[model samples]
Target: MTADQSVTEPVAATGAATMVDVAIVGGGLAGSLAAAVLARAGHRVTLIDKRAVYPDEFRVEKIGGPQLEMFRKLGFIRGLESVACPYDRVLNIREGKLVDVSVGQAYGLPYADLVAMARGQIPDASSLIVDEVTAISCSDDVQQLELASGRRLKARLVVLATGMAGALGYKLGIKRRVLAAGHSVSFGFTIARRDGAPFDFNALTCYGERTADGVDYLSLFPVQAGMRANLFMFRDPADPVMRDLRRDTEATLLRLLPGLRPYLGDFHVTDRVQNWVMDLSVVEGHLQDGVVLIGDAFQTNCPAAGTGVARLLVDVERLCTEYAPRWLMTEGMGKAKISEFYSDRDKIAADQQSLKMAHFRQALTSRNDIGWDVRRRLHFLRRSLTHRVDQMRPGWLAQVRSALRA
Candidate 1:
C-alpha cells in the first residue's frame, strides 16, 4: 500500500473511500501505538491526524517505570531509545536537603518525537493518512469517517484517540464531565548553565518547601535540547507568579524554590516557555456502538501526579492488543464489546489510580489541614531516612525486603 500524498476530492461520487479493519482518529502517542500494534498484527489500519507532523507540544515529555515496560512489551523500546535521552538516576531533594534518589531507566524526549517514533513503527507508511476527521458515524457493524478533504474512510471499528480535542467527540454526543477544572498547572522549558558547563546531576527533582506556595515539585531531566525542566503546581492559573514564571522563569523559579538556586548555578531558559492548565475530566455517554475512546479522549490526568502516560499506555495495550483483536473476530462492534474495554480490570485500575494520585498530590502540596500537615512532614522524613539507610547498605536492605515479601 502506498501513502496518500495529499487529501483530495473523493475518487468516487461518495468521495474516495478506503476500507480498513480499524480507523483511528488521532495520531498522538496512544493512537500511533495502537495503529502500529494492530498493523503489525496484520490488521488493515488507517491513522488520521490533522497535522502531517506532530508539533512541539508541552505534554508528557518522559516515559519511565511501568511505562517503559509497556513500550518494550509493545516492541517500541528501541524506537524510543533512538529519539530520547536516557537517564537512570534522579536526585530528589526538599528544603535544600537530599530526600531520596530514584534509580530507574527512563527516557526523556519531546512528545512529538515520541509520537513520531511510534508512527514510524508502522511498516506501511501509507497506512497513516494526514487529514482531519470532520465527522464520524458509528454503528454496530461498520463505522464511517468524513474528512475535511471530502475523503471518506470506512472500517469495522473506530478508535477515538483525539487527546483532549472534545470537539469531535462532542459531535458524537460524547461529553467531558469536568472532575476538577484547572486541577493543576505545568510548565515545560529547557535550561542550560550560564557558562555552558554540564550539570553534576543526570536528573533532579526538587519538591516545594511550603504548602502556601501551591508548588508541587520541579523536575529537571535530560532531553535532546538540554536539561529539561517540568514544574508542576497546584496554584491558581491567574496567579501573578504564573506570568512571572513565563517571563522571568529562572528568577521566578528560584524565588518559588529558593533551594534550587545553589544547584542550578546561574542557568537560563533556552527555549520558549510552554505551560498547560490541565483539567481532570472523563468523557460520558461514550460507551456506545462501533467506537472506543482512549487516552485523553477518555479522561485527562493531572500532570503533577505523572499518570498520563501510564493511563494511556494501558488504554492502548488493553484495547488494541486484547479487546480489539477479539472484537474484530466477532460479528459486530456493539456496546457489549465496547464496555468490556471500558471495564477491563487493568484499564479501570489505571484510571482510578490516576485520579487517586491527582488528589493525593494536591493534598500533599497545598492542603493545610492538621492531618495533612503531619502527613507531609512524615512523608519527607520517611524518604530521607530510607535514602540514608540505602546509602549505608547499598542493595542489602532492598534484597532483605524482597526476601521478606517472598
Candidate 2:
C-alpha cells in the first residue's frame, strides 16, 4: 500500500489493530531509515517511538568512510549533508608532533539532528506513532505490538531497531551477552577558542602519549554549534580522573593530552561534558520468529573504533533493502526467514568487524606488554613514514598502495 494510505486511518473507526507490512519499534536512525525505505517501496510501515522529537543525546556524532557510501546508496546523502558540518581533512598528531594528515570527507553534528533528518525521510506523517511499546508478541504468521497508548498494531514482520535499549527485547526472552563489561568510556562536549576565533585546522585527532593513561584519542571536528570533541579511553569509569574530567574538564583534558594544548590554544568547554560507559555486547536468544533486531539493538560498538554507524547501516541496508522485502513477499515471518538476515554475509562481517576493531582499539591503547608496545610503536611509525612518503611524492604512494592491493 502507498504511504498515503496509512493503516491508522482504517483502524481508528473500528478501534481494532492496525495491520501493517512492517512495524518498526523505535524512531531512531535505524528504525526511521527502515520505515522510510519500506514506506517508499510501497509497503505498509508503521514506525513507533516514544519521542516525537528525538532529544539531544550523545551518540556517534561524526560519520565518514563507508558510512557515507551507505547513505548515498540509501538515498539519504543529500539529507545528511544538509544537517551536518562537512570537512575533508583531519590533522593527526602524536605527542605534540604531526603523525600524518587524513584527507577524506566527514560530517559532524549532534546525534539528535542526525535522527531528526532520518525521521524526516518518511513520506507520511501518520507512519510515525509517538507512543511507547509496552509489550510484543511474535509468531510465524504475524506479530502483535501493544503500545502504551492502548493502540495495538499487527505486522507481518517487526523490525526491532530500538538501539541499545534492551528492555523490550528482554521481555521477549532475548538477552544481551556482555562480552566485555565496562569496556570503554567516551566523553562528548563542545569546545571553542577563548578569543572566539576559528581554529586553524578543519579537524584534528590527537593520540595518547602513554599507554598507562588509557586514553585512546581525542577527535575534534566541526558541528553546527561549534567544534565537537569526542574523547575515547579504555579506563576505569570510577577513577578519580573521570570525576576531574567532568568537573575540571579543560584542565584535566590538557593534563591528560598535553599535546592538545598547543593546537587548541586556550579553549573552554562550551557545554556540559556528556560521558558514557559502554559495554561490548551482542544479543543472545534473538533468533526467534516474526521479529528481527538491527543496529545497537543487535550489537554494541566501541566509540573509539568508530564502527557503530557502519555496523548499523549494514543492518538497515541488508534487512530493509534485501531481506524485509523478500520476507514480506513470502508466506510467513518465521524463524527460518529471520535467520536469513542474521546469517547474511555483509551483516555478519560488519558485526564481526565492529567487535574486532573494539578489541584492537582497547589493546592498542592500554596494553603495555612488550608485544603490544612494539606493535603500537610500529603502527604509528608505519603511518608516519607513509605520510612522509606521500608528502614527498603526492601521487606516488597512492599508486604503489593501489598496485599492492591489486
Candidate 3:
C-alpha cells in the first residue's frame, strides 16, 4: 500500500465507544509516523492496523537525499544507521550504453531503520490497537470508528494514512481513479563480497526500457560489500514482460547484465518477495470537511525516485509543525485550511515526480530501439543529452512542459 487508500467497510450496528484525540488508520510508514508525532504532542492517539508488526523483510531497501534530512530531523538517523546501505551514486544505463547520472547530494540508508526511527520518535507501542476498523463517521467535533469486535472510538480528529486501498479514503467520498502506469513487482535480495559487485556505493542504476519488451525502471542503493542490497525489477502482469519475471527472475537478470553473471558468489534467495501496485497519479484534493488525507493518500510518486518514505515523512514534518498540537485541539483548522495544505504539498511532490517521469518516459520509449539501430541512433543520443534533473537543471522547465501536456 503506497498511501492511505484503504477504507473501513460499513458494518453491523455497535454501541460501545471510547474517546481519543486522534485516530490513526493504517500501520505503514506514514500512519505509524503520524501516530508518533501526534503522541509526542500529547494527543491521545488510537492506531488501528490490520497487522500487529512490520513485514519482516521489505523490498524497499534504501532511503536517500531529502528523505535522509527528514529522518535526521525526526530523530530516525540512528535507526537508519543501524540497518543502512550507504550509497552516493545513481547510474543510468540505456541498452548497454551509459546515459546520465542524477547528481544529488545526500546518502542512502536502509528502509527498516527509517521506519523504526520514525516509529521510535513516538511515545510507545502499547497505545495503538492492532485490529480492524469496520466503520468510521466524522462531524464537526468528533470522529468515530467501530472495531470488528464491536468496540468504538470517537476522536477529536481522524488522520487517514492508509495507503492505496485503505478504507477511509473511499468512505470520505474523495475523487479517485485507478492508475495504469506501472506494474506490481518484487526485489530479489542477498549480500555479495565487496569485490563481487562492482556497483558504486554512492550510485543507483537506471535502465531505459529495462525490458526489451518495454517497462520503465530504476535500480537503487548499493550496500557495503557484506550487506544486502535490493534488486527491484518486475513486469506488468498484463504486459508481455511478465513471462520472464514470474518464471525466471535469475535468468532474466543474467540476460540484463551479461558482464556481472560470473560475479554471483554463492548468491541465492533468502526470503519471500514483497511487491505492491505502483500508481503514478494523484487524487485531486485530499481534504474534506471532517477529515484530512496525508502521504500516499494524496498522491504516490513513481518508484524511480525511491523516495516514498521520505515524501511521507515530509508530510509529517509539515503537518506536525504547521498545525501545531495546540491548534488542532482547540477549534480545528476546518476543511478549507486542511485542503489548502494538502494541495500545496501535493503540488511540490507531483511537480518533482512529473519532471523525473518525463525524462524516464522518453528514455524508456526509445533507448533500446535506437541502441540497436545506428541509422536511427537518435534515441540513445536524446537520453544522454538530458541526463540530470534538479532545481539547477533546465529539465525543471521540461517537467512543466509535460504536466501541461498531461
Candidate 4:
C-alpha cells in the first residue's frame, strides 16, 4: 500500500501507537515536502504538526535561481507556479541610478500559502496528523513520538524538519550552536501608491546608499494583494531607527533611501510592518540513531543572503531522494546511515555556501574598510559595465560566457 493509503490509526484505551516507515516532525516547507516525497515513494509516512494551516509568517517570500531547477527535479515546479505570482524582470538600482536589469524567472507569495501548497501534495489525507509532538525517543530499531493528544507514533525513522523550534530536539540532546547572534534584521510590508496606480516597474531592488545606515537593500515585488517590500539590514534591532521605520515606515524609508523617492511616487505602507531578527546557527550533537535534522532545525540562514530555501531544498532532495530510501532498505537507522546525509557533498556545499553568502552580504553592505570599499565599488562597477556591454551588443555576453565554459 502507498504511504498515504495505509495510515495506521492510534489504537484506543490501551495506548497503542501507530507504526510507519517515516515520521516527519514539522509541517513547514521542508517537512511537508519531505513527507510528500517519501509518501510518493511508497514509504509509510506520517507528518505531525500543531496546526492544520500554516500561519501568516514572514519567511522566504521570494524564490528563484537554482531553486527552480531543484523544484523541477522534484516535480513540484508546476505546483509552485500555481500559488506564486511570477515575474521575469527586476529593475535594479543603486543610489537612485540604474545598475542593471536582471532578466530571469522569479516568484513571490506569502510563506503561509507556500507551506499550504506543499502540504496539499500529500495524497493521503490521514498521513498528516495535526497535533503537537510533545516528546521523542529514538533508537537504532525504531523511534517513538509522544503527541499532546496522548496518541503516539512509532516509525522506522524520524525526520526532524522543525524550523528553529528546538524544544523537541533539545529533549533529544540536539543543541544549536549560535554562529552569529543577531546577524541581521528583516522587515516585510506591502506598499501602494496613494492614487491607487500600478507601480512603474514589475519588480525593483534598491541598494543601500550609505554604510552607516546598515541597510543592505530593499526588494519590491508583486504578491497577490499588493506590492510586497522586504527591507534587509545589519543594524542593531534596539536602535531608535527601527522603531521609526515601523511607526513611520514611508517617511523613514524616504529619509534612508532618498533615491527611492523619484521611483516610488506618493506611496505608503499598506499593512503592518512584519520584522524578524535572525541568528545564524547550526545544530550540534544531531548525528544519532533513527532521527535526522533538516532545514532550519539544523542551520539558520540570513534572510538578506537568501540562502535558507536553497539549503533546505538541498537537504530535502538529498535526504528524501537518496539517503533515506537507501537506508530504510537495510537493517537499522544508525549514526553511520544518518551521517551519509550530513556529509553528502551537495548538502555540505549548500550549507557552506549559505554561511559564506551571509558573511559576504553583511560585509559588502556595512564594511567601510579600505579593502572592502574597493571591493564594493568594483562589485557594482563590474555589473554596470557588463549591463552596458550586453545592451550595446545583445547576446554577445552570453555567447562569450558559453565559449568560456567550453
TM-score of each: 0.97, 0.96, 0.73, 0.97
- lDDT-better candidate, 1 vs 3: 1
Estimate, for each residue in 113-156, the C-alpha lDDT of model 2 and write its tens digit.
99999889889988888777888999999998987666788999
Candidate 1 regions exceeding 4 Å error are 1-13
Q: Candidate 3 residues 1-406, lDDT tens each?
A: 2212243343345555778777888767787777887787777887777665565545356666677787778666766676665555565665555676666644444454545556666687776676677677867667778776556788777777776754557666666665546633445444344345543335546353444444444364455424353444444546544455445655665565543333343344333434444656556545555566677776665554465665677777776656536447567546755665565665477446654664455345334555544523565576576554443586785688799999
The digit string of per-residue lDDT tens for model 1 on 24-52 reads: 98999999999999999999999988777
Worst 10 residues of 1 by lDDT: 1-10
Candidate 2 has a TM-score of 0.96
- Model 4: per-residue Cα lDDT over 321-399, one tens digit each: 9999999898899888999999999999999999999999999999999999999999999999999999999999999
How much lDDT does candidate 1 score?
0.92
Superposition error at 377 for model 4 (Å): 0.8
Residue-level error in angstroms, candidate 2, position 244: 0.7
In terms of lDDT, model 4 sits at 0.92
